[model samples]
Target chain A: MRRARDPFFWGLFSGGGMLTALLLPALFLVTAITAPMGWFGMTGYEEWATLAGHPLTRAGLLLVAFLAFFHAAHRFRYTLYDGLQLYHLDALISIVTYGVAAVLTVLAAALLILVV
Target chain B: MKSQARIPTGRISDPGYPRASNPEYTRHHPRWYRRRMPIFWWLRKLAYTKFILRELTSQPVMYVTLFLLGKMWVLSRGPEAYETFIQWLSHPALLAFHALVLAGLLFHTVTWLNLTPKALVLRVAGRKIPGWAIVGAHYGAWLGLSGAIFWILAGR
Candidate 1:
């Protein structure tokens, strides 16, 4: 019998879901909404650079990006498969979804490494 | 579409098989139709529409992650590049898009947290914990975290 890898991806799905649920709302509000709208006082170059360049902050951001990618991949796979009834293209859907997630995660890591 | 193709016989020898391969069996049986799911199946039901929308919230989550990754990459290119990227983030068009993204994230958070009790069935000793307790705890933690983030980002 072939061993199904369902649980592994499901783990990523749930982990990503929870993290994104808890963090993304506030994070987006501050960074993308309030700050961008000039609601949050802009600290400008030195402060922003230091924050992004910090090892701990970079690590945290990378982790969030990695899990969020897989979380999106897993959920979107079923959204395509069942929601759209694209089950006939099951193998193709899984590959494209997870493949994109993995590639993006690697890209995030690379960018984080250069954040200095 | 043979009339007897879908009928089952008790004998093992007459078990279900492909109609094309067993032409003799299909000759006396009707083809069993595979009910194809409609592309707009979600539109037919409110429950399904909500499910799809919940699933789709991942897109904005992924988008925000990518945007941050881009921000990080820009930072690596020095203050000039970083300033330009921040300027782009403040663009009215981009800000408007992010506002929609924020709505999606909030929806995802509320839905996910509400569903947490069902996903996690907690038991204390012999008795199961109440659903509202589980839900309240989740909301409590969410508020704590969100408050901390706001303080760090916007507090004096």
Candidate 2:
């Protein structure tokens, strides 16, 4: 039988993204639990706004935002297409989901530039 | 659409012949799609746009990023810097962005909350955890975090 479009690539990409999302909570949990105890050899910045001045922190935040946005966009698009029986509008749905993801990437970048 | 044409019910006396072929299935226009192709296309695109916008606006990245950055800032300098940063977050422009991000965050939370059951397994004794339970947990977490922040700042 002739093979249609390959689903393997997308399956891998999306699966990896979901794994990242699942891991994020663990990081957050560790931070929350350890922070109060002062175990990580970390010190607080003098001002909360200082994060805006720090390039690494700002960039990391933006990266997280962009990834999460794109991941959610992809998942939601498929959920709608399959679960909701939206076969006819699949192309339009794809375009819009990607569009939103792109805008989110832009927003995250803008935030990083302005803040960092 | 004839199944008999595709499926050979072997009637050979010798019964030694084997047949293999890809069968053709009927293509359907699902009544609704047939009558509303143009309008469906337009509405479909519009709905697609809405979904995309919804996902983009409600990213968890925004909140989690800000929170982590705040945590990191506190770590680098001390509580003082973090406090100052929090205070600065209320700056007119920053606050405006905050408002927008908050709206997005809420939208994301609400929609994803509904996806809890399908996305994750929370079974017990061969029974699955109710979606409402998952949603309630999130709501509780959100409230708890809000309260903690409020308490910390109010006390300080």
Candidate 3:
């Protein structure tokens, strides 16, 4: 018998949910909000570039991106299914949402590994 | 005879004909008179509104992750492009949107962490751990993780 995919995706979803909850707020605070506002003397581009390029940081970012994308896809699936009552379009909806998540995860891996 | 009427006789029957033709299947208050839900039905109650909002908060988390990927993509284009990314981030409109996204993400954190006790049950000896301790541990971990990130990003 073929293995079920639900539990695998669910594992990713919950893992991503947990990781995102723990770390994303501070990341946003530093990267988008305070750093953009130039607080804490976070103006230097070279430092960020260097920090991002580190092997460890790139790996961490990739892990976060990979899991977070799946988490989003799973939640978005249920959101549309129940909230908007779009259960009739289950196959189409699942394909679209999870497909987007997969595409975005690949894009993230590319950016983190090849670019940054 | 009534039991004979109730029991199956290995006969095929019209699918909808029986139920539809029943004497009690009145048109005035048909059992099938399900209330058609509007598209925005979740707006009816505060609990539903919050539940949907929590579900939607995942989108912002996804968006922020995408934003991070975009930042890396921008950095690949050289210093000028990176600067442009920062400049775009500094715009009032973009800042406002991010602020809202931030709020959504924070909500997701709080809700998800609080809900963890249900998902992650732990027992010590024969007794289960209390919900508060589990929640507190999550909060504690969140703070520790947040502190490490800030230390790395904001520390000189």
Candidate 4:
């Protein structure tokens, strides 16, 4: 059966989430070695800010943020349906979740432009 | 038929509490306290664990709060400011927190990736891609990216 929503969006979002999950930990590790206490603080933050400014990081974070936001929204919709029995209120749940996701996408784009 | 029904009135024995002259009634009733207490207790505990997991995984407000903090920090300082902010993340105490957060993020990624096939509409020659294949591709990419990063960072 055809899905009610765009599946490719989810796939891409999930893929980004997975990629970030893997990359972040290693980045954390390196940050640990070079960093004072294995923590990424203002200096590390600066590096990230640099990444934000960089073309690659900007592109990557934008993709990750857009997809991850929607993926989380969809998961949340299902959670509401199952746990809260919001089946009767499916339309409301979808509207709210997707709406939030849309806002996050815009925010992510803004972050890419201004931060990176 | 009601009037002729046999009523067996036998003293319910409390074998464990033999010392008591008046043992607690063992006869079943609608409320059946003695019979249901154990099962009810087990269910009550089970409900608590489920609640904890739900709270841990989907605490949207908490995640959003942190995410916003990150976003705001980025906006104000740009990369240089963020670098300073990230420097603080390296403290041993913070390392512990990062480890915990990392584990949670990993769980989120795998589960999210697994859902790709279901969430996305992808067809290959009129055939839908299997969910396992979708998940496998994610893992494969993860490994590839990880290896590449390690090679670059390790200066190989």
Question: Model 4, A1-116: lDDT tens per residue?
Answer: 11448576556435545555556544444433334343233334444344445577567656656655665666666666655554579889879988887887787677666643
Using lDDT as the measure, which candidate wins?
3
Write the candidate numbers in order of decreasing lDDT: 3, 1, 4, 2
Off by over 4 Å in 1: A1-5, B1-31
Which residue runs does candidate 2 get wrong by more than 4 Å?
A1-46, A49-63, A72-116, B1-101, B148-155
**Candidate 1 steric clashes:** 9
TM-score of chain A of 2: 0.64
> lDDT tens string, model 2, B15-34?
33342321242355345445
lDDT of 1 at B97: 84
Misplaced by over 4 Å in model 3 are A1-5, B1-33
**TM-scores of all candidate predictions against the true structure:** 0.85, 0.40, 0.86, 0.55
Clashing pairs in 3: none
Distance from true location, Cα of A93 in model 2, Å? 10
For each candidate in the order shown, give its overall lDDT on alpha carbons: 0.82, 0.52, 0.85, 0.55
Q: Judged by DockQ relative to the true structure, which candidate is superior, 2 or 3? A: 3
* TM of chain B, each: 0.77, 0.48, 0.78, 0.44
lDDT of 2 by residue, A6-97 (tens): 25424432442543333344344333433333334332343333533667656656666666656656666665664456788978987897
True contacts kept of each: 0.72, 0.09, 0.78, 0.21
The TM-score leader among the candidates is 3
Candidate 4 C-alpha lDDT tens digits along B1-156? 864333333434533343343346455545635432332232357664444343234333225323533654454665565455556654678768666665655555555566667766679999988878877886787778867655544432
Best by DockQ: 3
- Model 2 error, position B79 (Å): 18
DockQ of each: 0.67, 0.11, 0.72, 0.16
